[model samples]
Target: MMDVLIETRGLTRNYGEICALKPLDLRVNNGEWLSIMGHSGSGKSTLLNLLGGLDRPSDGFIRVGGEDLRVLSEDGMARYRREFVGIIFQQHHLIPYLTAVENIMMAQYFHSVPDEAEARTALERVGLGHRLKNRPGELSGGEQQRVCIARAIINSPRLLLGDEPTGNLDHGSTRVVMELLSELRAEEQFTIIMVTHNHEVAAWGDRTIYLDDGVMVREELKGD
Candidate 1:
């Protein structure tokens, strides 16, 4: 049986007079790596935000792991984000002063209790064991992204969302980040939904969906 991890029906989002996402249906299976691709203002990030609980849809239904997102209260949504979703952004939103491990521990603090040892292990899994004490300012672009990945996965979320996570990286760094994500996904068995404009980045996913003007225009399977 196919384990559907995420599903949306007639999902829509609006900003006053502007509709950011049109009524659309989507389904993602457990442990699937799904990539969203589009030009700016095409509603890729808007869809991601709706899925991650960062933003609510204007109308329609979204369900993840059997929970309906539209009915969740603010606190309920917060809890859902903490327990079910992990997100990475292009900006690497780490505190400038905190060390890599400290940043990871901070995420744990929000999800439950902070454990330094577990945080250390998370960083180590991303091949950053030697750079635990380095702050974001001290790390290279790729290393900083690795720290972000470590932090995102620290809470053991069921769904991982990335918004142009490799947008700021060079080719080498991008490859490293994607490879690390692939390895971690295999081990952790979490579903991934990533938004990216880069074709190379989108190609790494098992499937890709293209959005244009808030509508899903087309989709491609891995080899198609």
Candidate 2:
């Protein structure tokens, strides 16, 4: 039996009078790779933010691993994010002043105790063992992104959320990053929900869902 890791009912989000996301009902199975595709204002990021507990839904409930997000306080949501969701943003939000290893250790610091050994292991897992002392400015786009990936997964989050993670990479770098993510997922068995505008990138997932004007317009399984 497939375990449903994430489920949403009547999920909606609004900013002022603008509805960023229409009522959505989504179910994500454990260990599934789900891709979201949309145009500029299609609420793709909004959905991801909600799922990561970075933003609260205006209405409805999000249940992940049996915990109801709607009922969580701000601190509770923070704890939820630290314990369950790992987000990789398009910008590779690493502190420019910090070295690759330190950027990862920052995540560990926020989670609880910061362990240099574990941080080093995570960076090495992302193939950055030799670049640990390098700062973001010293790293290439792909290397910086690898640092971001290492930081995201340092806490061992159950769900990995990627918001245009490969948006800034070249073809070769994109392939490397995607393959790294796939390898990590295979070993970790975490669910992944990635938002991308490129169909080729979206095709990497097990299934794809397209959104338009805050509504889910289509969904396609990989083999279909």
Q: In candidate 1, residue 213 scores what lDDT?
A: 100
Candidate 2 segments exceeding 4 Å error = none
What is candidate 2's lDDT per residue for 1-224, written digit by digit as tens? 99999999899999999999999999999999999999999999999999999999999889988889999999999999999999998999999999999999898998999999999999999999999999999999999999999999999999999999999999999999999999999999999999998888899999999999999999999988
lDDT of 1 by residue, 1-224 (tens): 88999999999999999999999899999999999999999999999999999999999999999989999999999999999999988998999999999999999999999999999999999999999999999999889989999999999999999999999999999999999999999999999999999999999899999999999999999999
Candidate 1 least-lDDT 10 residues = 140-149
Model 2: per-residue Cα lDDT at residue 19: 99
| TM agreement with the true structure for every prediction | 0.98, 0.98
Model 2 Cα shift for residue 33 (angstroms): 0.4
Candidate 2: count the clashes.
0
lDDT of 2 at 148: 94
Clashing residue pair totals per candidate (backbone < 3 A): 0, 0
